[model samples]
Target chain A: MKKVTQILSLMMAIFFLVSSMGNAQSKNKVRKMEYNSKYNYEVATIAVGVDGTKLVKVWGYGPKPEEAIRHAKELAIACAIFRGFPPASNGAAAKTPPIVTDDSVIEKYAEFFDNFFAPGGKYLQYVNLSTDAPPTGEDRVKVNKKTYKVGVVLSIAFDELRKDLEKEGIARRLDAGF
Target chain B: MKTLVNFIFIIALALNSFGQAKKPTIMVVPSDRLCISKGFSQTFDNQGTQETLPDYKKALQNDGDLRLVISKMSGMMADRGFPLKDLEQELKNLAQEAAESNMMTSSSSGSAISESPIDILKRTAKADIIMDLDFEIKRQGPNKYIVFTLNGLDAYTSKNVASASGAGQPSSAATPEILLEEAVLSYMDEFNGRLMTHFQDMFTNGREVKVMIKTFANAGISLEDDYDISGNTDMLSMHIEDWMANNTQGGRFNLSDGTANFMRFEQVRIATEIERNGKMRAQDTRMFVNELSKYLRTNCQIESKVYLRGLGEAWLIVGEK
Candidate 1:
């Protein structure tokens, strides 16, 4: 009976330790993926909204469809601020220059951006899914056994975003005369 | 305590003055290619050469599409806080001035002075930047689309400062104007960004302008004439160069060409404003040349006449007004 109790206590300790370790590992993975998605993603201007917004299609990767979709929003805003859309063939789409022209600005304003792009953070205010339905099979693809890639169309209030950046002293205002 | 208050007040005044900096005035015009392609150009004799120029008056009167396009672009720019000089309004003003001038002929010769439409526009508008627009509508079966291009050219230098071009999505029911509006909306931000960057660069490097120094045929003085100032004797041209070096922002300017009677300074970067009477005043090529004229009068005992061609080029003819 004593041996069984000791074994049961050891098993409980082991279970708790394993669960906490798994949680730490998952947290680390999320941080790493966030950093990767911030720098690496594909974004294209799908359409422009009449009310000073931009509809961009961005591809984001994660371990699940829901996670990928969340990353897609973050990537969409990041691309709009840093990597602008390329000119399309036959003049199909206009070339949009990035809001932040300086390449080193991300690193310089890392703290501000980190807080801005955090989960359920200020970046959510600028962007939303273009459609009411969730992404379908084609839009959500399994890139590997452990990773899923999702394409999302997000409408970003680009002008408002630019104004906010200018207000935050990250970007210069067009009317800020010499 | 009174002295400290005065010091604080002076600091506040200076800060307030700095906030009143000027912005470049913008005017929208049809591109030369658009005018020529749309049969809105006229042939003119220029010093024995046949030259073609855009007939802006004809274009404005005949083309409804052009009017809509210009209105859309100007409205968009105005919304962005840029000051715009309306082309159509300026044209009317020109016509009124022409009629008035025709009635008031010269009393001695009974002849009236005439100016070309382009010249009148330039003199009246004096825009620092010209936004040249070009566009074409394309059709694919029942669907219609528009391809558009906008070029921001420096009015003074005629250099392309910013440009945006693209095609709008094909639509079955959208008008050409709507298609153009869509295309411009997508590209205007980038184009405006480039424009603002260029303007900010002017703040750092100064505004680019041209200056030419000439001597009157009967005037005894030449650019090569030596002038003595503060125990330093130098040619008038050298003195002018030294003044330009001292007064120009960052001492930036180019002596593109020089002769005994003619000296042309291209890429003369002049300050946008200067301090006078303990206050800041706006400056242009005219104001800049006026300063040079004053300098010559005060230091070299030389009288000069300043002639300005629009806002960018100035001629300082020594020994005569």
Candidate 2:
């Protein structure tokens, strides 16, 4: 009877462990986009990155690394143009990614970006500038079989800190002896 | 039942067809003179010696402070709304390339020599932001007066707004703290509010607007004979926040309320690359202006004024540079 009890307890522990792992993966679904398409074809790569920290999307795909990079750049630029630089129009979500372009690589590109920025990866991407750049700690993410890299997304949210930005004379760089 | 099902389907489709607003990111470029030294030899020399420019550093620190201050400026022009996920990867990739170049791995994939914002600044040399600044102190009796010259401020399409590359001296006699404060304050007054709009037109519209102011610091200009003190003299005369703003700076102007449906005049800067031999050497001042214009262009409407001392007036950006 004692031996039977021990085996039952062991089975319970394994079941719990498996359940926890499943929960963890589910939580990470948003970070690492699950393939939404009907098919999971043989893909050479499926990397991901954030959309300027404004929009969290996945983006990456190619038969090779260069092709993946090209697809990623194309996706990133589409996002950039959608935001439209400096944002003349107000009431717009500052950190949200612009409308994802409906292109051939949209799905893979968005996924790559989302994974690149989620959770960790700050140390690898941004320059310190020694200014008020947001905290980009030693966060890392691995994609395309490459070692983990910084995934921190820094967006200077000036609206919240408008008073501070103006008082610092940020525009003085244009003049003499600046 | 059929109608309700169709309505629900339409609602779902509508929700999917929306754009999530986003803030853009802007990487600022420092002044031109501070970017690189004159000629390749000077660049090689100063870079070889790592002595920090305490004054320039101070100014940069001040700009950092100002960035905080401007974050408070309301309406459209605020913090640079950036798309981080997309940009971070691009920057990371670029950073990787840069690291590879520094390592001198010529065979490395994506081995292009990545330019730091500073490198970009130097390559484009000219812009509204002056790179290097110089000063000459002349002791007159009990008071020591300093003459400061700004270099690398490019003029616009017309020759009216002159570049301050060689020198445009503005004299002053104030304490160090006061000198720095006054220099920033006074200059800002000359270029804030609607003035930003006016400035943007010059830069993006093809017309340029450049101004140089020289002020004296508390201790006066110290160590005047430094070889590394030459400023980057070619900077843009104006600022353009929009692509369509690029127009030729010339011809008719009603001058009514200092604005018109379309207007053009001089008082501008030009953006021209300066290169000698097959190797490139210099860039015009518009580079910095271009950077600044990015901030403003994102806005739908801009409202501001130019203030000199206590006097202020509303203005607008229009026409070509």
Candidate 3:
């Protein structure tokens, strides 16, 4: 009975020590301490045309600073592509009648359009708009204990993006010049 | 075979119509401030203090001038697929809810009573926009003229989306109703045009959402710094800015205010879920903030606490981890 009690006490001490070590590690963790923002992008408009150059901004979250930066850069490119090919309808269906005379045709090509409008399409040729200058980093925000948020800004040539879409037959070009 | 073909054609048209989303709901209310200023309200002594308020009940019952205008406007909106929310029905529901809640939460000692906040009225109405109507009649020589103004405001944000004011030619009409209608009819197209323009902008840009970024003073991190988490060196601010640009519809967002410790983003289009009257409706605003929180959690291992105010505003605190 005495031996059993001594062994139980020894086990309790080891368990307590391990638990305290875990607590200490959490308490002493070196976190990224990133800023939490409500807005998506910062404003830096350098007008080159009537519509102005689209400044595609994106945020990247990663366990490391580099990962977040890389992710943000990728997001900026994706945003530019998506912005270039926004939804055809802006909820004006009530005022304007449906353009698709045959619903079945739209239904058939719906999947193709969905895939076509994604980040990278086979028809799209990307011209590096970031050629004007290298990407500018904005903030380093530390999220929980492990993650960090980094912001990157890229100047996407909206004119070029529009021209590419029209050339690819994805969009119809208007006669009115910008 | 002809009948079957007709049936299939009808089905196709029905399906196509169903694919379109419902139009936004609008509620029209007489502006209390305008009514008071124009001497259209009632004044009474409350606790020996004189108080004046819009006599909408009396106006609706006895005055046909505004009533005719509302009826005509509502008819036009309904024809355009925009549904009108009844102010009387909304008030009735509010009163019923208040009575039921009061009965349920009655204390044993009868000392504690719960008071409902003013915001509950907005939620119960469930209107996407509120159209405030104001009008004034002026007498010039032997003729009387009416001038009217309509202000369209977003229900959640209380931001004016559209506004227009116009006056009608002086008429010898005996009643205010006929004269007011004539005045409103002259500029109805212009007023409707402004409203449609605002709605189209909102539909294209996405509903406006206010985003605020706050940093803890003790976080030991500045907004403009190279963060080295996971062996990556990048300016954290730029990454956040990029995320905002990517998520918003048409990349439409405005960074109205930014500092090392605080950042305010206006017109951020984030799809959000709003809980109203015990039912969660798919709206947008909270979703944007949630997306930011999720990105931080997944990428930076940073945990964020989100505090949502109403439907269009969100506050996020960082560096708490």
Candidate 4:
């Protein structure tokens, strides 16, 4: 009977110790975002830099890292073109209008606009800014497959772009600053 | 069926009217140079900063040019049904009250709640808009003409919402008062229209409030720290989101930017209240920072110091308590 009593006391002590340890761990445990594991899709991230007057930032994503970066430069050029020749009348919810051309008397030159935005284009010069690291914190989402987020900041002389855009009739030369 | 339709129509009308805001109160003051030239300004220290502000007290003293201009402007506004706040009279009252209160309260225990002169003016008058006048009487060959500039500013933000400037046709009026009045009245319609449009936008879209939240560098704490074991979100961040949603009318707030240690909220619309200063009143934005600070202290267990600039922007530091 003495041995049995000693065994019971030891069991009780072990149970309490386990329970307290669990409780302490639980006290410090925090919640984190849950992402789907079933979807094997790549997540693309883009962040815009809006500070420099003539420098515009762009980001693109692809299957490979280099391809993603190359795509980002193209995106940067596209961004510059859009910024220069922005549709003034379009509201946030407005639908994109179809581009049309007469083709005989006037050339559409859509490809010309793209060529200017392309890397080493005459109207624009590219200056690469620092690449952004992945966002950190509890809110950061995890993806199942390999993902790519590539970006670049292009330094395009806006005055040149403005003048070219005006010549192309894409933008007016009226002074925006009063 | 007819009675039911009538009841529904009445309800709709009431709801429409409820969303509409009443006319805002306005106060007119001469521009700094004009005030100084006309002897409406005085030199004084605001808190620890020594600067010159318009002394409505001296300006309101009997038979001053600023007083005459303000009175005429007030009459014009009153005729248009817009409420007018007399800055001079209000300042005088405030001075009298401060003197009386100071005599009764001992110096050892200064009032825990102290307001700056501008704050007292804002609190008392509850004027939403301040109209600043910069006028000069130009002496043409045979007549004296008024060359005036009018700026409608948000009392809280100090943002110039509307402005108008033009030279009035020369009038052979006997006094500068009549000449100025005639000049102002000539453009008053357009000026008042601009003022009304700005106030209407504020009423419909809600007033803009800019808020910046920052944490101390050495506090061993960040906005991303998880305070609750059962939740995954950061403690301060979640609380800020909830506060912005709950405090703004109709959840009318935009979280413009957010990072681990900083957050910027723009276009926040706090519910405006009609406060009385003497008999004049307007919708006021005073409750925003007070309520936000109180929430941070109570719920997050984090004390914050709120720094308000003008009326519309508030800066809060979490570790500065």
Q: Estimate each model's TM-score.
A: 0.81, 0.23, 0.48, 0.47
- Comparison by lDDT, 1 against 4, better one: 1
Model 2: share of true interface contacts reproduced: 0.00
Residue range B150-239, candidate 4, lDDT tens digits: 888876556788776666556555478766655454445346545555654565566666777888786656777765423535577787
Q: Cα lDDT for residue B112, model 4?
A: 44
What tens-digit string does per-residue lDDT give for candidate 3 at B1-321? 999999999987755544332245688888897667656688899999999988665566665666777877776565434657876677678778767766764446665355557445534545667789888888889877677778888775678877766565565655677666554443343355456566555555566778887777777656666655567667666656777998887777888888777778887775333344554445645566877878867776666667666466777766664
Worst 10 residues of 4 chain B by lDDT: B275-284
Q: On a 0 to 100 scale, what is the lDDT of residue B286 in model 3?
A: 59
Runs of candidate 1 with Cα error greater than 4 angstroms are A1-38, A102-115, B1-10, B18-20, B44-51, B97-125, B139-144, B166-174
User: What is the C-alpha local distance difference test score of each model?
Assistant: 0.82, 0.31, 0.58, 0.57
The per-prediction CA RMSD against the true structure, in angstroms, equals 7.5, 26.7, 29.6, 27.6
lDDT of 3: 0.58
The runs of at least 3 residues in candidate 4 whose Cα sits more than 4 Å from the true structure, single-residue gaps closed, are: A1-178, B1-24, B43-53, B105-126, B171-174, B212-230, B235-321
Q: Which ten residues in a row have the lowest lDDT in candidate 4 chain A?
A: A90-99
Number of the top TM-score candidate: 1
Question: Candidate 3's error at A91, in angstroms?
Answer: 33
* Clashes within 3 Å, all models in order: 0, 134, 42, 3
Error of 4 at B295 (Å): 6.6
